[model samples]
Target: MSKFKNLVVNLSLTLGGLFMGVIIGEIGLRVASIEGYQKIGDFVDSAPTSFHTAHPDLGWKLKPGASGEWKGEGASFVRVNSNGLRDDREHTKAKPPNTLRVAVLGDSFTEAIHVPVEQTFWSKLERKLGNCAAVKGRKNVEVLNLGVQGYGTGQQLMMLRKKVWDYNPDIVVLAFFTGNDVINNSPKLEYDLYRPFFVYNASGKLVPDMSFRKLAPLDRNQRAVSFVDRLPSWLVNNSRILQVAKKADLDLKKRQISKDFTVLRANNFNPPKDAVWDNAWRVTEDLIVTMRNEVVQKNADFLLVVVGDPIQVNRDPQRRNKFMQENKIQDLFYPDKRLEKLGNREGFRVLTLAEQFKGYTEKFQVCVHGFDNSVPCGGHWNEIGHRLASIKISQNLCQQLKQSQLPKR
Candidate 1:
């Protein structure tokens, strides 16, 4: 009986010690005020340290000289060059002798972390263009990928000014993703304030808004409450050690289950529903024109490549028709057509890929947007999609260059 009582007392003491340790650790962490070790929601959607770092103007950029295994719908070992480009080759600010340089810019699709650097559209385009008549006079073709994940058109324009002009690209290709670029450009629509935004002033001109850099770190109030809500809210909120541990656990789980795919909603591909969306579209168009003007000022040819969303290129006609019908969307090609018209009106070349991709998907009946690790028909472009993009973009550029004289060496 004495032994049993002693055992109970010892167990109670051990529990008390653990509880005290936790309290002390929590207090120490709070007092230390270590960044990312703080409260919940402080670092939500924060870029991985291995791949990205915060930028003053662009908000987030690929960490220069960083290499990591990117596991999304598709998996690849991605490396960022010293210039923060996702390329295997290093580039100098000056163009190489007798070489034609093409700078490709866009968001995640152009950055292409889901596939190998060699297999990306821009890399493949470089190789493909080498054989084309477009580079008949040039000894080499260099395609510089200035793509970063989650970049809006506004950010791409900023990138052109800050980084791209240094390389002296003879041509600039803007790979516009119809998926969420409209929302990405609009401050009113995109809630993430870490990135740069362009807004229209009272004078009806596009004004750069870099206010996000000066703003305090956004609070978690905007984030939807998740399973964490099940825990004691006060305890979770107050305990920094607990939040750090929870974040680590979640990170581990995410790494373990890396097959999560980003399947965008139907509305993302549809026409504007309200004035906010209308403004987003207008701002996106203005941003594109701004990019064109910059490229023109540098005496570089600009090609606006309108990338088709997965649904627009779905192989199954029934699925495509059903999605359009259910969504009440008159045309799946609406965004593509609109951007193409903008390019035409603005005197910049446009290449719309949705109709061609739809035909290719129907003919080949192969998955372009996903991988074996993810849904076969959704997410970022797979190897086949990249290959198709390289083929089409190379062909288009070749034809354009054939008609127009190549930039002088």
Candidate 2:
């Protein structure tokens, strides 16, 4: 009986000692502000980390005139116009005479909330186009950016119908990202929590549904409820020590899972291949054809640009090799070529930044938009990336517009 009591006492003492040690370590790490102990969202109060107003049609959109100080992988002050656009200027219903207006549509690549408004491609393109217009005797060139982050192609189509056409554009540019878009086509799992999605019907026609309910937005009246969404993370993240411990735990989990991890590829979100991707090609084709028809009915030209993911453009040999081999990704140009083929068949000009970006990457490290460019990193575009895109698109667009407006000669 004495032996048993002693064993129990020792076990309890050891556990208590370990608990106290953990508490002490946590406190020490936090007080030091040791590196890699902070949650990324703790620095940014924007979409993905925060919720915006919900729409039954487009899934989510920033509140018009919503301005927030942003700090993230890249930090910038973000502002949205009254029209739910991330531009500083307001667009009127009437486009000025002798003006060429272009409306850009897509996901975060086009939205680029991480960068300043002036630094965005559409804004930069707008500035460059103004100069070009001045030389060509055109009055003005307006580019409306109608990008919402995390939007799927179907949601983009819905947005085009619900909001964009009011701008009376001369050109409509749709940017496609190959990363998770393929899987975004269907709303099978937690997709409803993300965005309004589409599914393949019995006739194999793409059908849109927002039938699944979205999470109710945080209520200002219900501070307790509203704070609930952020509390758990906030509590842990505010303590740098807990953040470090959590990160270490996550890193260990990732390493362990990575051994058995099958790369989801640009295509495979697994079950979504059938639920989402199986109809992705057909649905995308239909949506583009429909969107183009909608634009042409208004006498606007449609241009499609396939944006390369960071993985496709990563200069790091180790990370690049892993993505390539895991996804059985042979050609880096696979997305561009596939999109170009579709555009050709549809009789629209499709351009890709793959070759253009590669040319620039030969001299510079073309990495994802983030604070860091190291391996196991990034999927977004930084300011430089946006600048590169703006230059290429602007030059090409000006040339195309100038040629199109050549007095029908």
Candidate 3:
């Protein structure tokens, strides 16, 4: 009985020592490297460190080597909030009183990621529109950007209804991107690379995915798992691991999954093309109609700007097929010429860079937008592409505002 008591005491001491050691080690690790610890909401806030001091409007990290007060390396424009919205309380010549406030909505392209505040298309348009003296004093054209990365037409419309409409804007600009917008609508496991999970019910009310909500409770556990996941990505991404993993994943997916573009494209892929495209289009149309009705209710002007992806804008036709082959990705509902035709027929003001900047890359592999010649790293337009898009959009907006002044026949 004495021996048994001794053994129990020893065991308890060992377990206590182990627990204390773990606690001490965790505390030491936390204090030793501040950079190792990630703050909560860092992903949503755009900045990984110091949320309080960070600019609320510019959440995402700009490109490397970005400079200038008005512009940054990857960004195309400067976003000004209501505090900076006016020069004075009375409004300046640039921003006059009673001027029509214009709100631009879209994804990263419209947001002008990695660029400076002034270089964004919206900023350029504001500058151009400010030059008009006829309505300059009488009215001001304030352009507000409510763009979030990875947002689709449906999300943008929802944002407008929830946030943008309250600003009392006279005109709303809907900048539509062709790449990945359709794919973004479906449910998926991946969150960091795309927008978080959200579902629109039959009543059209947006709701957070229940699974996502459940995951939130397990954030600490997930964080620990993420650390492990990052280990493989870090080592492999830097060395032979990445190559091996990439090859293995590709080979496995190829052998296991059917190579049908339409089949493997979306999360929900059983439906026919007409059903899929029609459903997406219907959702988009409903959102637009909802916005239009809201606009009428609030007496605002509505304009749709259809922006194309580099792949779609290039209109090479072969590019989509090539992409599918290279990435082992299915084309899905997009790359369908019929969809593009339908978008146009539905009165969407289509602005394709391929059509806008044709034959400009004879000597160099320059995109229509005139930035450095490189295929997009992640499926988004580079700085130069965004700049070109902004310029074109601003020009059209200016023309539209001027036309609004002409007497109706």
Candidate 4:
């Protein structure tokens, strides 16, 4: 009885020390200025009206009628409509009379939770297009933003068919952010696997890969949160130790993938030297062409907008030049030029925005990208960036519309 009592006392002391240490650690983390700790475990949520939810077809989607405050680079209240679009109001399947409809597609840049809905590029484009002669007889213009965060070209194509066609848009603009869309298209390159992918088959034809749906919750690591993710939000949010561990794990994974897939590196500007990268580019090009063909078949115009990455549009010429020298690339617009060539070959209009954005940066020394909390000139576009994109896109789109000689419906 004496020995047992001693053992119990020792065990109690050890557990008590650990409990106190954890409490102190949690308090320290909350006191620190670390960002993104209030929500932990998973990058997304699965609840209805959550930021994102599991989809039977698309892997994940903006939960229809979801509302939340988005913070990172900037703060904005994002409200998803009943149709799962980040918009002020629900859109109709049928185009309204005397209204010209334009559909925009891409990833987070197009979704743009960093800024207000009225300040997004597509929203501003609507107001701009309304004043232009692009639709000679149309009294109004509607630009539908069909973008979702973390989406690649494969998922965008799926969206074009599953949701976009129902709206009967007169134009389809694909906002291609070259920074990660290449990796996003490749299963071997992209870490997130909850979404759909296209893989080349034995006959060199691209086929759909929907295996993610069959994986267990933990394996997917997306779409649905796992047991680890179910830790009380307050505990996870306040625990410095847990936050450090999670960040370390994420960094390790990113470093492992970066060994082959370097983001914003020379590989993106130059030709692929390996099969994996070659396949990634091929898959992306094929997906773009497929989207264009589908839109053209429906008598709608297709425009591929090569959105500029922040590094490519840095206000300081020294930084831009240094990056170019380190990357050993003569041209910063290599990806844009390549995509422009593809659009020319495939009979769709292309607009390369990097050159314009770079010029704007050089002339004004103003940063269009990044938010107050992020690295300087890094991350998504700010209000100025959206405005510039809207101005350029509206101008180019107006020209293309006039050239098409579209009928006044």
Q: Report the Cα lDDT for residue 406, model 1.
A: 55
Q: List model 4 lDDT by residue over 1-409, tens digit each.
A: 9999999999999999999998887677668855332334334443223577878778889888889887765778999999989898889999998878999999999999989998899999998987788575666899999988889999999999999999999999999997888888987777677778988789987778888777654556432332334567676566677656556656665566555444434567767769988889999999999999999899998889998878789889898788778778787777898898898898888988888998998899888898888767878999989999999999998887787676767
Q: Go through the candidates in order and give each one's C-alpha lDDT.
A: 0.82, 0.69, 0.51, 0.82
Q: What are the per-model C-alpha RMSD values against the true structure?
A: 7.4, 6.7, 9.5, 5.5
Who is ahead in TM-score, 2 or 3?
2
TM-score of each: 0.81, 0.73, 0.58, 0.81
TM-score of 4: 0.81
TM-score of 3: 0.58
- How much does candidate 2 score in TM-score? 0.73
TM-score winner between 1 and 3, please give it: 1
Candidate 3 or 2, higher lDDT: 2
Model 1, position 168: C-alpha lDDT score:
97
**Which scores better on lDDT, 2 or 4?**
4
Tens digit of lDDT per residue, candidate 3, span 151-185? 66656666676667567777788776545555555
> Over the full model, what C-alpha lDDT does candidate 3 score relative to the true structure?
0.51
Mark the regions of model 3 whose C-alpha exceeds 4 Å error after superposition.
1-96, 131-138, 188-281, 313-321, 324-354, 357-365, 368-379
